[model samples]
Target: MADLSVAFVGKKLRSPIGVASHAVLNEGLSGTEKETEQLKAYSDLGVGFVHTPFICPEEEHPKDAPPGWKFQGIRSREPFMMEGLLVATEARRIMCRLNAGLNMIENLKENLPDDVAVIANMIGPGADPDGWAEHCKSAEEAGADIIEMNVSCPLPASEAKAVQEYSTGEMSEAAGSLLGDSLQLLLPVVKAVVEECSIPVGVKLTPETGFPRIIGFAEGIRNAGAKFISGINAPITVSPPDIYKNGQGKWPGMTTNPICAALGPWDRFLLYRNLGTISLFVPEIELAGIGGLVEPEHVVEAMMLGARVCEFSSGILWKGTDIIKESLEFLETYMDRQGYNSIEEIIGKGVKYIVPVEQVDWRQEDFIATVDDRLCTRCGRCANNICKARTLEENPLRIVIDSRYCIGCGLCQAICPEHAVSIVEQKHPVIGISVDE
Candidate 1:
C-alpha cells in the first residue's frame, strides 16, 4: 500500500487530508465538550489533523447572543446539492472561549492517535500585534501541534449592517477577512505570533485577497517567518433570493436577505488559485488547501496544484465523517495505481504545466471539430446558435463542420449532448502551406 504519511511544517502527518475550521452545532458553556467529541470522531476516522472551531482570546461570551446556519437549494433527500450556506453565529454560540479552547486542545492531544495532530484555529484580538502573539502563545502552551491564525472567517465583515457601523468607527474591530486582506494590519500580527509561539504558525487567508494581491500576501507571510498558508476561506456574499417570492431570502427562517458566507463546490477554483499562484511565486512557504473541496478526487486535485495538505469543511457537513474515510481509502488506492509511493511525489506535480496565456501555443490549426454521423441527433443547439464553423443542412437534416473556419475552439463539441462532436487532430493541416504544393 502507498504511504499516506507526509511531513507538514516539521510534523509528520499520517495523511494529507484533514478537517478545516468551521462552526459546530454546540451551544452554551459546555460546547467545548461537543467540539472535542467531534474532533475525536474525526481522528477516529484516521484523519491527519483537525482544527478546532474558531477559538477566540476572550475568557467569557455574552449570555444572549443567537446562532444560526441555513442553506439554499437543499433537497431533504439529497443534501449534497446545496447552492451555499448562511452561517450567522454570535461569538457566544460558535467560538470557543480561550479557556475552553485550551482544554479542548489538551483533551484531543491526550485521546487522539499519535498521528492525528490537533491544530488550534485561533482568532486573535484583530490587528493587535502583541495581543495576537499572546493568544497564539497560549495555544502553543496548550500543546497544539500547529497554530492556524483565523484571519479569514468572513463573520466579522459579512454583515452589511455591522460593516456600515464599522465604517463610521462605531465598531472597534472587524477581524477575519478584514484582517487577512490587509497585509499592513496582518503582517505584524503574523510576525508577532511567529516570534512568540514555538509551534508552526500559518495564516488562513481570505478569498477577498485576489491574484497579484495574494502573491504579495504570501510573500509577506513568508518574510514574517510563518510556515504555511491555508485557505480561500468561504467568501462573503448574499445567498440567492427567492425570485418567486418577490426577492425574499431563501434561508429557512428568514424573510430578509443578509450578507453571509458561501461555501461548497464553487470554492474549488478559488482554492486552486491560491495553491497554484503561491506555489509558483512564493515557493518557500507551504500551502494547505481548503474551501470548495467536496470529493475524494478534489483532495488529489488540490495536492497536484501544490497543496501539501487538504481540508474539507462543507463536504464534511454535507457528507458526514465518511468523507474522510472515503478520501483516505481513495488516496491509498489512487497512489498505488499511479505508482506514487509517498505524498510528496504528488504535491505540486501539476504546477509546472500552469503558464501565462501569452505563453500558450494556441495550436489552432492542429485540430478541428468532427461529428459522428451515426450518433448525431441533428440538434441545432451547437451550429444554429453558437458556432459559425458548423452548419445545419436540410438535405438529410445533418450538421457539418467547416474546418477552415473551425479555429478548434471546441464550442460545438462542448455544446453537443449526443456525444457525437469531438475535437481531433486533422489529417491535413489547415494553416500551413501544403508541402506537396
Candidate 2:
C-alpha cells in the first residue's frame, strides 16, 4: 500500500484530509454531545487535524447579549440569533472546562488520540490584536499543534480587522487589499500572534483578484513568521437575501445583516489557481487548498496543484460524515491508478501543464456559444450584467451583438438568464501584443 501520510503545519498527518472549522463544532451554539463525539469519530477516520473555534470567554462575551450582537439589536429579540450566541458561548465554556487554561492545544492532546493533530482557529479585528495574541497563547498552553489565523471573514466584527477586503468585482481594490497597504496593516497582528505562540502558525486567506495578490499575501505572511498558508476561502459570494417581510417592507436575516458568506461550487477553479501560484513562490510552507472541494477527485486535483492539505466544510454539510471515509478510499484508488506511491511525487505536477499563452494552439479556433432567445425575456439583465459596449438594445425582444467591443470573452453569453446569447465567428481585430512578442 502506498504511504499517504504527509507533513503539514509541522507534523505528519496520516492523510492530508482534515475537518475544517465551521458551525458544527461551535458546541456552545450547536453544543450537542453528539458533535464532540463526531469530532472523535473524525480523528478515528484518519483526519489529520480538527480545528476548534476562536475562544471568547463568557466574560468577554456581551454582558447583555454580546458586544456585536447587542449593538446589532437583533440578538436580544430573535430566538435564532440568540441561540447562535448561546452556542458560541457554551462551546467556549465547554472547551475551557475540558482543557485547563482553556487551551485548545491541551484539550486536543488530552482528549484525542496521539496521531490526530489539533489546530485552533482564531479571528479578531486589527484593533484587538492583543486579544488575538492572548487567545493564541491560551491555545498553545492548552496543547494545540498548530495555530490558524483567520483574516478573511466577511462578517462586520470579523471584517473590521480582516487582512483582505472582500472582492467586489473590481480587480484593483481586490488586489490592493490583499497586497498593497492593507498587508502592512495586517502583518503586525499576524506577527504578534506567531511570536506569542510556540506552535506553527498559518493564515487563512480569501480568493482575491488573481494569483499575484495570492502570492503577495503568502509572501507577506511567511515574512511575518507564518509556517503555512491556507488559500481561497469562499469565492463567488452573493448579496444577502431578504429574510423578513413587513407588509411591503422587507428585512434581511440577522446573519445576513453583516452578510453570511459560505463556499460553493463556483470556487473549484479558484482552489487550483491559488495553489498553483503558491507552489511557485512559497514552496517551503505547506499550503491548504479549500473551497468547493466535494469529492475524491477534488482531493487528487488539489494535491496535483501543490496543496499538501485540503480542508473540507461544505462537503460534510452536504454529504454527511460518511463522505470522509469515501473521500479517503477514492484518494487511495486514484493514487494506485496513477502508479504513484506518495503524494509528494504528484504535488505540483499539474502546474507544469499550465503553459504560456504563446505556446497554446491559437490556430484551432473552435469557439462555440449558443444563446436561447426563448428564455430571453429581454429584461436586459444579461446585457446589463456583461455587455460593456452598450450594443444590446431593449424593446424589440432580441439581443444584437456589437462585434467590436466583444473580445469573445463570452461574458454576455454566460450571464444571459434567458439563454438568448450565442457566439458565432465574426472577424474581429486581434488586440494588443501576443505573449510571443
Candidate 3:
C-alpha cells in the first residue's frame, strides 16, 4: 500500500488531495454553519489541508473604470456559473461577500474539527505587503496553520489591479511604474509575517509570465524566507458562449467574456509547463499545483511533473464534492497498481517524459478532410465559426471540399455542430507527413 500521508504548510496531511480555496468552504455568510460542517466532513474523509478564500479586510467594487473594466471579485457579473448553493440571511450573506477572511476564520474556529488544518489564503496588491503581513499574523492568531499568498488572480478587480503591476510581461512594467523595481515592497511584510507566525508561508503564481521572471520572483520569496510555492492558477482564458435565454426571446449574445478565474483543460497544460520550469530552480521546494484538475489522472500527472500536492476546485463545480472522495480512491488504487509505496517516490517520474523541442517534427506535409454529407446540417455554424481557409460553403447544405485552400488542420471538422466532417488520407499525391520518408 502506498503512503499518501505527507507534510504541507508545516503540518502532515492524510492525503495530497486537498480542496482549493472556494465558495464551498466559505459558503458566504448565510450558510457559515453548514459550510463548517462540510469542512469537517472533508476532514473525516482524509483530505489534506483545507484552503479558504484570498482573504482581505474588505471587498470594494472598482470605482474608476478602464476601457474593458469588468467587475472582479468573488461575485462578478461574469457568465461562468458556479454550481454550489448556500442558505444564509441577506445581511450575513452580504458580510460574507465583503470581508471573507474575518467571517471565514471566525466560523472555522467556532465549528471546524480541531484536527483539520486550516490554510488562510490572502490576496491584495503587492504594494500593501505590510497590510497583507498584518492580516497573516491575524490569521495565524485565529488558528490558521498556514498562509497562502495569492498573487495570480486573472480578473482585474480592485485587489487584482493593485497587484497587476508585479505580474509577468507588460503587467510587471505597469507594476514597476507604480512601485519601483526593488521587489522590496513585499519583503518587509513577508519577513514580518514569517517572524510573527509559527506556520509556514507559501506564494501562489500564474503561468502568464516567462520562466526567468517566475524564477526571479520565486527566488525573491525564498530569500524572504517563505517556505513553499502553490500555483499556476487557471492559466488559459476560456470564452464560453452564453447559454441562458431571457424572457425577451433569444438573449442578445454578448461576446463571451474570458473566464475570469475558472480553470479547465487548457489550464492543465500550462500548469505542466510552469511546473517544469520551476523544477529547474527549486527541485526540492514543495509545490501545490492548482487549476484544471478534473480527474485522478490529472492528479497523478501533476504529481509526476514535480508537484508535491495538487489543489482541486473546478471539477467540483462540474461534478460535485463526491468527486473528491472518488478521485482519492482512484489515486490510491493507481499507486497500488503501479507498485509505488509513497507519493514522493512517484514525484517527478513523469518530468522526463516531457519532450524537448529537438524531439518535435515541425515540417508539415499532407492530409485531407472528408465531410459525411449525411450528417451535415449545413447550419453554417462550422463554416462561419472557424473555417480560416474559407473552403466550406452553404446553401444546399453541404461543405464543398477545396483541396487547394484546405491545409487539413481539421478546424472546420472540430467546429462542425452536426459531426459531418472528417479528415481522411487523400488518395492523390502525398504532400505532408505521408510524403516524407
Candidate 4:
C-alpha cells in the first residue's frame, strides 16, 4: 500500500494537499459561520491540512485602500490561462474573521478523525516586531499548528509608515509582497516571529522578487529562522489597456490602468523557478508548492522538484473544493503505479537533472531533423519561425534543414503544426558547416 503520510514543517500530514489562504476565506464580512463550514468541508474531503485566511494584527489600518480584483480569460488553445490582478486591502482583515478562524481551527482539531493541521496565514504589523510576534503568537494560541508569514501578498501598502517602507522601491504600503521582498524590513519580522512562536514558522514568498534575486531571498528568510517556505504568491502586474480607448479593459466598465495581482496557469514556470532553485541550491529549506497548480499532475511535478506539501488557489476557485479529492486520488494512484512507498521518495528526484547553463553540455551531433513528407502539410509555420536551422526550398518548394546551424535543437520539429518533423540518427555525425540536405 502507498503511504501518503509525510512530515511537513515537522508536522505530520496525512496527505500533502491543503487549501491555501485565499480571498474566499475572508469570512469576516460575509460572516465566520460560512468560513467554518468551508474549513470543515475541506477536512471532510481528505485534505491533510487547512490554511486560514490572511488575518492581520490590527483589524483596520489608519490608512486604508481597497485593492480590487480584475480577471481576464485569454482566448487561446494553449494551457488554460486566466490572468488577473488583486488590488485589495489587507487593512480590512477584521477581528471577526480572526475570531472565526480561531474557532474553526479549534473545532476542526477536536472533531476530525485524523488530525487536520490548521496553518494560520498572518500579515506583518508593519515595522513593529513585538506586534508582529504577538500576531503570530495569537494564531498559535488559537490552536494553529503552523504560522505562515504572508509577506508575499500582491497588494500594495496603504499606511504612512508602510508607504515610507515602500518608498525604498515605490512598493505597496500594504504588507503583502511589498514587505516580503524587502530583505531588511522582512528579515526582522521573520526573526521576530520565529523567536516568538513555539510552533513551526513558515514564510510565504513573493514571485515579484524576480529570479536570481529569489535565491538570496530564500536563503535570507531561512537564515532568519523560518522553519519552511511556501510559495509562490501572486505576482504584481498591470492589465494591458485597450489601445482604442486608451483605458484598461475590466468588468462593469473600462477604468484607468491600475496595478493588480496576477494569478493562474501562466505562473507555473515561475513556481518551478523558486521551488527548484531552493531545492537545488538551498537544500535545507523545505518548500511548499503553490502557484500554477491547476491539475493533479502538477502536484507530482512540484514534489519532484522538492516540495513537501502543495496547494492551489485560482485552480480551486475555478474547479471548486473537489480538486482536493481529485488531487489526492491522483497522488495516491501515481505513488502506487510508480512503485513508491512514500511521498518522501519522490521529492527532489528531478533536481539531479537540473543544471546551470554553464554545466549544460548540449549534445549537438547525435542526430538531425527529418521532414516526413506524408505528414507534411507544408505549413509555413515552421519555416517562418525556425530561421535558425530550417529554410524553405526555392526549386523543390519543400522544407530542408541546414545541418550546420541546426545543432539538432529540434525547435523545427516542435514548432511544426502538422507533426511532420522528427529527429533521426545520423550515420556520420560530422562537424557542421552547412549541408543543404
Candidate 5:
C-alpha cells in the first residue's frame, strides 16, 4: 500500500486532494447552514482540506448587494470538448461575509475528520496591509489551520470595461488578481499576515502573472514570508457570442456577454507553469495546484511537477464530489505501481527534468520514424499531410517511410488514426548529423 498523506506548510494532509475555494452552494436566505452542510458532505467524502469560499473582511455583505444566496449565482458554458469549461459571474457572487466565513471555519474544525484541515481563503482590503493582516489573524483565531490569501480571483479585474483607456493601468479595490500581479501591493499584505498569524500562510496566485514575471512574483512572496503558492485562479476570457443570435452571449438567460472566468481541461498547462517555474526558481516555497485539473491523472501530474497538494474547483463542478474519492484511489494505485512509497517521493520528481529548450539534446541521428505494417490501414492520412518522409506506395496500397528522409519528428505517429506509425531507435546510429539534413 502507498502512503497518500503529504506534508504541506508543516502540517500533514491525509491526501493531496482537496476542494478548491469556489462559490458556496447555499439553499436559502440564511446561507450558513447550507454552506456548512455542503462542506460537511466534502468532509465525509474524506477530503484532506477544504477552503471557505473567498471571504471578505466586512462583517456583513454590502447592503447594496443582493442576498448572499443570490450573490452566489454562477453561469457556465461548454462550447466544445477542447474549451473545457468557461465560467463567468460578477465578482460579488463568490464573496462570503466575514462573520459567516469565520463561523463556517469554526464549525468545520469542530466536526471535520482529524486529518482534514481548513484553509481560510481570505480577500482583504487591498490598500490596507494592517486590515488584511487583521482579517488573516481572525480566521486563525476562528480555527483555520491555514490561511490562503486569495489575491488572484479573475472576476474582480475582469469587470473593468476597457483595457485600452488606461495607459497608467487601472487598480480595483476588490483585491484579487490586481494584488497578486503587483508586488508593491502584495508584499506588504503578505508580510503583515506572516507577522500577525502563527499558522502557515500562502498566496493563491493569478494566471495573469505569466512566466519570467512569475519568477519575480514568487521571489517577492517567498521573501515576504509566504509558505506556499496555490493557483491559478481561472483566467479571464469572453465566451464566443452566438453568431445566429445577433452576437448574444451563450450564458443561459443572459443576452449580454460578460467577461467571465475560464476553467476546465485547458488550465493544466497554466497550473504546470506555476508548479514548474516556482519549484525551479523558488525552491524555498511550496505549491498547491488548482487550475484545470479535471481528472484523477491530473492529480499525479501536478504532484510530480512539485505541487504538494492539489485542489479541484471546476473539476468538482464538472465531475462532482466523486473526483475527490477517485483521485485518492488513483494516487494509491499510481504510487504503488510506480514504486513510490510516499507522497514525498512523488513531489518535485519532474522539476529537475525541466530545462531550457536550448539545453535539450535533440539527438536526431540516433532515432528514426518507422511504419508498422501490421497495424497500418493504408489510410494515407500521414503520407499526404505528415512530412516528406512518408509516401503512398500503390501496388500494396501502403504508406512507406524512406529512412534517409525521416527525421523522427513523430508527427505521423501523433496523427495516425490507426496507430500504425512509431518513432524508433536506429540499429546503426549515425553520428554528427545536422537536423536540416
Candidate 6:
C-alpha cells in the first residue's frame, strides 16, 4: 500500500489534502467557536491540515462585517467551456473578517487532532514588519503549525489603491495582491514574519505576476527565508453587467459592476501554471496548490505538478467535507493501481515532461489524423472549431481524411463524438504534438 503522508515545511501531514482558508460568515467575527467547529469537522473528515481564514492586523476590517461569501457555479449551453464561479464580498475579509483568526487558531489547535495541523492565514497592514511579525507570533503562540501570509488575495482591503497603481505601473503598499505583486514591499514583510514565527512561514502568491516573473517572486520569497509558496489566491475579474438591468452588474439586488475574484474549477489550470513553474524553477521552496480545485482528481493533478499540499475551498463549499473522504479513498486505490509506494515518489514527476515552449523538439512526421470510414456517421461534429486542421469530405456523404489540410493536431479526434477520427502513423511528417518531446 502507498503511504499518503507528506512532509510540508517540517510538519508531517497525515495526507496532502487539506482545506484552504475561506470565509465562514458565522464565526469569522464572534470568535473561534464556529471556526473551531469547522476545523474539527475537517479533522473528523480526515483532512491532513487546515488553514484558518485570514487573520489580519486588528485595523484590517470591522468586526461586524457584511456577508462575505457569495458564490455560484457558472456554465452555459457549452458545458465545460471555461466553467468557473465568481467570488465577491466586502473588500476586506482579512483576519477572518476582523481579527478573529488568532482565536480560531487557538480553538482549532485545541479541538483538532494533534496530528492535524493548522495554518494561520494572516494578513498585515501593508508591509509593516511590527504588525506582520506580531500576527505571526500570535498565531505561533496559539499553536499554529504553519503561518501563511495572505499577500495574494484578489480582494484585499487596498483594492482601490491596487486598481489605480496597476495602470500607472506602480503598486500600492497595501494588503492583498498589491503587496504580493510588489516584491520590493512584500520581501521585507516575509522576512519579518519568517523571523518572528517558530513555525514554517509561507507566502501565498497572486496570479497577477504573469508567468516568468512569478519565478522571480518565488525566488525572492525563498531568499527572504519563507519556507513555502502557495500558488494563487484567485484571479481578479470584473463582474459582467446584467443586460436587463440597464447594463448593471448582476448580483440579485445589486446593479453595479464591481471588480471581484474568479474562483472554483477553472482556476485549477492557473494554479497548475504557478505550481509547475515554481517547481521547475525554484526547487528549494515548497509549493501548495489553492485554486480551481474542485474534484478528487484535481488533487492528483496538483500533486503531479509538485504541490506538497492541496487545499479545498470552493469544493468544500459545494460538496462538503465528504470531498476529503472521497479524495483519500481515491488516492489509496489510485496509488495501489499505479504501483506507488509513497507520495514523495510522484511529487514533481511531471516536471521533467513540462519543458518550455521554445525547448520542445517537434516530431511532425510520426502520425496524422485519419478518419475510419466505417465509424464515420457524417455528423460533421469533428469539423467544428478546428483552427488549422478541419478535414471534411462531402463526396460520398461521409467524413474523409484530407492529409493536406490536416495538421494532425488531434483536435478532430478529441472533439469527435462518433469516434470516427483517429491519429495514425503516416509516411510523411504531418502530426504535431501539443508539446513535442
Candidate 1 to truth, TM: 0.91
Per-candidate RMSD, Å: 4.1, 10.1, 8.7, 4.0, 4.4, 4.1
Better of 2 and 5 by TM-score: 5
Query: Best to worst by lDDT, what's the order?
Result: 1, 5, 6, 4, 3, 2
Model 2 C-alpha RMSD to native: 10.1
Question: After superposition, which runs of candidate 6 have C-alpha atoms over 4 Å from their true positions?
Answer: 59-65, 93-99, 164-174, 372-377, 384-391, 394-396, 418-420, 427-437
Name the lDDT value of residue 209 in candidate 1: 92
Q: Write the per-residue lDDT of candidate 3 for residues 113-144, one digit (tens) a residue.
A: 55456888765334555566676777777777
For model 2, how does the per-residue alpha-carbon lDDT over 255-308 read when each residue is reduced to its tens digit?
433322445455678777878778876777778877778777888788888888
lDDT of 1 by residue, 1-437 (tens): 99999999999999999998875555324457777888788888889999988778776665676454555643333324455455554434566677888888898889988787888998888578898999889988988999999888777776545555434433344377777877777898899999999899999998989998999999999999999999688888776678899999877788977677778887889889989989999999999999999999999999999999999898988889889989999999999999999999999999998898899888988877777777788878887768777778888677867766777788877767787777777775434111112
Alpha-carbon runs more than 4 Å astray in model 1: 27-29, 74-82, 90-93, 160-174, 373-375, 428-437
lDDT of each: 0.81, 0.60, 0.60, 0.75, 0.80, 0.77
Single out the weakest 10-residue window by summed lDDT for candidate 5.
69-78
Among these predictions, the greatest lDDT belongs to 1
State which candidate has the highest TM-score: 1
After superposition, the stretches of candidate 5 with alpha carbons farther than 4 Å from their true spots are: 24-30, 63-82, 161-172, 428-437
Give the poorly placed runs of model 4, Cα more than 4 Å off. 60-70, 76-96, 157-164, 168-174, 372-375, 392-398, 418-420, 424-437
Query: How big is the positional error of residue 175 in model 6, measured in Å on the Cα after superposition?
Result: 1.1
TM-score result, candidate 4: 0.87
lDDT of residue 86 for candidate 5: 66
Name the lDDT of candidate 3.
0.60
Displacement of residue 82 (Cα, Å) in model 2 is 29
Candidate 6, residue 295: lDDT: 85
Please estimate how well model 2 matches the true structure, expressed as its whole-model Cα lDDT: 0.60
Shift in Å, residue 236, candidate 1 = 0.9
